[model samples]
Target chain A: MKSSRGLRLGTTLFSFTNEFHARQYSTEQLILKVAELGLGPGLEIVGFQSFRDYPEISDKFAEDLKELLSSCKLEPSCLAINADINIGKDRTLTVDELVVYHEAQIRAAAKLGFPVARCQFAAGPEVIRRLVPLAERLNVKLGLEIHAPEAVDSPLVLSYREMYVKVNSPYLGFIPDFGASAKALPPSFLAHFRKEGVPEKIVCVAEEVWATAEGNFGARLSEYHRRARQTGAAEADIHKLNMLFAMLSKQKPSAWIEIMPQVVHVHGKFYEFDKDGNEAAISYAELLPVFRDGGYKGFISSEWEGTAFTDDNGFEAVQAHHALCRRILARA
Target chain B: MLQTKLIAENGLRATSTGFDVEVRLPWYRGLPLSTVEIGDVVLNGEAINPASVSIEVNGKTRLPGDLATLYDERWYVLDSAMLHVSHSELKRGEQYDVAVSVNLRPPYIPGLTWAVKDAKRLTANS
Candidate 1:
C-alpha cells in the first residue's frame, strides 16, 4: 500500500473571512483557533486582509507574528499578496512601479517566515521576470496563482510558462487553485443567488449554461449573458452572476500534472461539503491524486470560500475539507 | 455582498447641517479611499444631492466628488465610515428609511466596478 505522500493539509485564514469581517475573531485569535481545532502545520493569510497597513510590515508586527506561530506550532505556508496594477485611478502602474510594489510584499513575506508568496496574474511576464533575482536573493518563491477562468493550458498561462522556461529560476512558479478545475457549479452557489433576489429562472439558466456551453470561458460567459438577458433578467441580476464565470472553471484535473513540478503551493478551494463529507463541487478524490502522483510536496491550504455566499463561520466546513483530504491521501 | 450588514444599527447621528450614517465596507479587504465612489443616498425616498455629501474615514473627511484624488487614504475593512449627508429635515429621535449605494472600483480588476447598496430604518441621534 502506498503511504501518505508529502502533500500536507492546512488552512488559509481566508476561510474565516466572514468571522473576521464580522469581528468575531481577532488576527491572533484566528491563529490560535487554527491550532485549537487541529487545523495546522501550515497557515496562509492574505497580507491586505490580515494586516492594517500591508505591503509594509512593521518590525513589531513581524516579531509578534513569528512568536505567535512558534507557540501555536503552525508553519507559515504562503502570503497572498496582490499586484494592484490599477492602484492609480488614471492609469495602471508602469512595469517599474509594479516591480517595486511586489518587491515590498515579497520582502515582507520573507520577514514573516513564509517560504512562498502567492502573487496574482496582474504581474505580467515582465514584472515576474524582473522579480526573479529579488526572489532568489530573498529565498522566497513567487507563485503566480492560476485561478479560475484560466487553467493549465490557457493562452495567458502558456505565455507565463514560456517566460518561466526562459527565466529558468526555481523561485518562479505556479500556485494552482483547485477552483480552476471544478467538477460542477455547486448547488449552494445557485441557491445563494436565489437568496440574493436573483430570479430562480435566471439562476437555472446560469446552471444550464455552465454545464453545456461550448467554447472558451469568455465565449461561454457571453452565451450565458445573451441567454439570461433573453429571459428578461435585469442588468443588476446579470451583473450579480457575472462573477460565477470567473470563480469556477471547467479544466480537467489531470491538466495539473503539466505544471506540478513548478507548483509551490495549492489553494484547496471548496464551496460546501455533502452528506458523505465530500466536497460538493470540487473533487478532492481526483485532485489529491494528481498532486500526489505529480510529487507536489507543498502545503494544500484548505480554502473554504463558502463564506462568500453564506453566513456560516466556515470552521466546520474547513474541518470537513481537511478530513476529506486526509482520508483521500491516506488511501494513496 | 453582505447588504444586511452594510448599515449599522443605531448608526444615525445628527450633524450641524444634516446627519451622518455609519456604513461598512462591503469588500473583504481594505482598499484605498480613492477607488471608492459614494453613489447615491435616498433619504425617505428623497435623493440627497451628491455635491453636498462627504465621507469621514481613516481620520479625515473629504467630499464624495474628491475621493478619486485621495489615493493615499484607506478605508480599513473593520472600521465603518460616516457618510455625512447635508440634509436639513432630519430630526433627532426620528426614524427614517435610508438607502445608500456605494461602488468600489477594485484596482486590480480593470473596467469593472462592484456596487453594494442597503436600505435600513435608523433612528437619528443628537
Candidate 2:
C-alpha cells in the first residue's frame, strides 16, 4: 500500500525553537536528532534563524554545515527565506530592492545546496516574477507558502496559478502548509479559552457556527457574531471566538488537488498528536490520499507548531507526527 | 524567536556603571536599524533610565538616545544588536528579571508585525 507517488518525509528545525531557546539542543544537535529519529533524509532550514552567524556565514561555516549534514545522512531540502517589505519607519522596500534581497537569499540557498527556497506572501507576484530568472539560473525552485487563512480559491492564490500557467516555468511553485486544511480549531486554543473562563456551552456554540456558517469569510464571520451574541456569550469570549475563526480555515482536504502539481514542498503543519498517533487538529488521513492520487513527488516536512500554544516537547511531537504519516502512507 | 543574553562573564557588580546585553532580533528580510525603537529597559519590575542607554555595533558605540540613528547599517537575518545600559542599581550575583520593549517598522502586511508593549520577563544568569 505504499504510495506510488514519491512523497518523502522530512522536518524543519522550527519545530524545536523552544528546545533551541532552552539550550537543550544546538543547531547541529537538532540536525543529528532529526537524523537519529529517522524522521528525514530531507531537512528544511530557516537560514537566518537557525544559523548562529546568519547573513554572514563564513566559507568555513558553510563547509562545516555541509559536512555535518553529510555525516548525518540528511539532505538540504528547502531554505525558508523572509521578504521584509518594511525597510524603515514608514519606508517600504521597492520591488527592485525586494528583488535584490530575495536574489541574495536564493544565491545563499544554492550555495548551501538547498534545491528550494520558501518565500512569504509579502513577496508579491512582481517580486516573485523578478526572482524567477535567478532561481532558474541557480537551479533552485522559489516556493510561495500557501498557509492558513488563505483558501485554495483565494483570488491572490488564483493569480499565482494564472502566472504559473502563463510563465510555464518549473521554478515557480507553491509550498502548501497543511494548516489550511485543518478540520478543527487547535486544541491548545480551546484550552486557553476555557482557562480564561469561557463557558463550555459558549464554546460549543462557536464551534457549531464555524462548522455550518455559509457564504464568504466576511459573511460567515458576521453570522458567527450574531449567533454567538444570541447565546449570551460575553464580549471577551466573543472576541476570542472571532480570533479562532480567523486562525482556522474551512477548506476541504481534497481542495488541494487544484494546486497539487504546483506544490514544490509541503509543510505538514500539526498541533498535537493523539495516543492513537493521529493529528488532533488537522485531518491528514484525508489529505495524504489527495497527494498520493495526484502524484505529488516532494518532501512534506513535519512542522510541529504546538510549541506556540504549549510547552509540549517538539522532539516527541514530531516523532508522533512522522509515525502517523508512515501509517497513513503505508495504507495509501 | 527573540532572545536576550548578558555578555558579562563575571556578572554585574553592585558598583558597576553599566553592563552589556545583546538583544537578538527576530529574523526578517531586512530592516533599517533606524526604524527599530528600543523602549524602556525594565529590570526586575523596575524601569531603567532611558537617557543612560547606549548601543554598540561593529566596535563603534553610539549614544544618540535613538536606536535607529545609532547603527550605521540595516539589520537582516537573525542578528544580535549589542545594547549597553548604564544604571547604578545592579547588584553582584543577583538574578534580575530583564525585559525591554521594542517596536519595529510595520511590514506591508498588517499581520506581519513585531512589538512588545508589555514587559515580558526573562531569566537572567548571575
Candidate 3:
C-alpha cells in the first residue's frame, strides 16, 4: 500500500468483522486475518458497541495489544472510543465532566501509545475548543469524523472548519469519512430531472418561489421533497444525490485541507461495485485523484456499510474495494 | 369499458376544457391509470372548473356522468371555503348504493404557501 515514494496503505478492521463469524475466530485471529488483508499497514478497531467482546483485546490489555500489533507486523492506527457527550440530552457540560469524559479518552489514547482517539462532535464549538488544550498536552490529537448524509458542503461542516481555523490548534484534526465524500450529487443531472417526471420549467418555478420564501435547509429539503413527490420523480432522487456529491467534491477543498492536518484516520466507504472491480456508487476515479492531490496520505478504512449488511457476497465486496483502492493509491 | 389501479403522479390540474389529472392519489403512489374519455376531450378526473354543486337530487343513480363529474370534483374558489361538486353525500355509516372514483395526492408542502391543507384535514383528529 505504498505510493511512488512509498506512501503506505492502511484501513480500518470494521469492514472485515463479518468475515470471521466463521469458525468463531478470536480477535487475535481477526488481527491475523486483517494482516492477511495484505491491504493494511493496520486496523482501527471500532468501539461503538459490542466490538469489545473479542478475546485478544480483552486478554492482554492496551499495552499487550500495542505490543501485539508490532508482534503481528501491523500498526494500531486508532481506537474507536465512545464518549458520552449526549449533545441532544445536554448542551453544556462542566469543565470537570469535560475532562472526566472527553479528556480522559485523549489521555487514555496517549497512555496506550496511539496518536489519536476519535471524538464525536457531540457538543458545540465551545466544547471542542475547550478540550483542545487538554488534547495538546496529552500529546494525543483528536480527530472528529465528518460522516455522511451530512455532506461536506453542509453548513455544519462550514461552521466546523470556520471554528477550527478560529481556534487554530494543532491538536484538532478531522477524518472526513470518504463515505461522505462518495455521498454526493453528480454534475450531470438532466436525466434525473426527466425521471422525476418534472419538467425543468416546474423545477425552475419552484426554485424561484423557494428563494423568496423563508426556507431554511429543512424547508428547502422538504420543498424539494414535495416537488419530487408532486412530480412522482423517485428516480430523480438518485440524480439529485449525484448532484449533491459533486457539489461536495468541488466546494470542500479548503475544508478538506483545513481538517486534513488532523486526519489520523478515515472511513473509506463503498455502496456498489462493477465487473472491472470499480465502485459503481461513486466515481472514485474522480475523488481518489483529489485525495492524493490534496496530500491526504492517511488511513482510508474500507467502512463496508450499506446494503452489504444483507448481502451474501459480504466481504467479497470489501475485497474488490481493497483491490480497487490499491489500484487508486498506486496511480496516486 | 376498461379500468386499472392507477395514480395521477403529476397530480390534478385545472384547465378550461378539462383537467390534466395525474391519477396519483392517497396510497396509490406510483400506479398507472387508463386514460378515460367521454367527449372529444380526455376524461381526466381532476377538473377544477367553477362547476355546479350537488343537491339531494344529484345523488340518485339516474344522474349522468357529466353531472356525476361535477358532483365529485372539488375546487377551492376565492373566499369560498372550497368548491365541492358532488351528486351523492355518503356519510360514514349510512350505507347506500354508491359508485365513484377518487384520485388523491399525498399532502405536499407547497413551495409557495406553507399551508398544510390536505395533511391538516387527514391528521386533524388522529
Best by TM-score: 1
List, residue by residue over A90-155, the lDDT tens digit for candidate 1.
867899998998999999999998999998888888999999998999999999999998988889
User: On residues A1-332, what C-alpha lDDT tens digit does candidate 3 reach at each position?
Assistant: 35623234565655654443322355566677667766566567654321333212333477776787787778766665543332111133454565565655565566556676666545445666778887888877777777643545577666776888898887777776665544233212333444546566545534443333333345545555555466654554423433232222323334455455556666666655667777754566765666666676656666665322232343565677778877876883
- Candidate with the larger DockQ of 1 and 3: 1
Candidate 3 DockQ, CA atoms: 0.01
Measured against the true chain A, the candidates' chain A TM-scores are: 0.97, 0.91, 0.71
Q: Give i-RMS (Å) per prediction.
A: 1.6, 4.5, 22.0
Q: Chain A TM-score, candidate 3?
A: 0.71
What ranking emerges by DockQ with the best candidate at the front? 1, 2, 3
Best-fitting candidate, scored by DockQ:
1
Candidate 1 chain A: 10-residue stretch with minimal lDDT: A1-10
Which stretches of model 2 miss by more than 4 angstroms? A53-58, A193-247, B1-15, B18-36, B43-49, B55-65, B69-99, B104-109, B117-126
Which candidate would rank higher by lDDT, 1 or 2?
Answer: 1
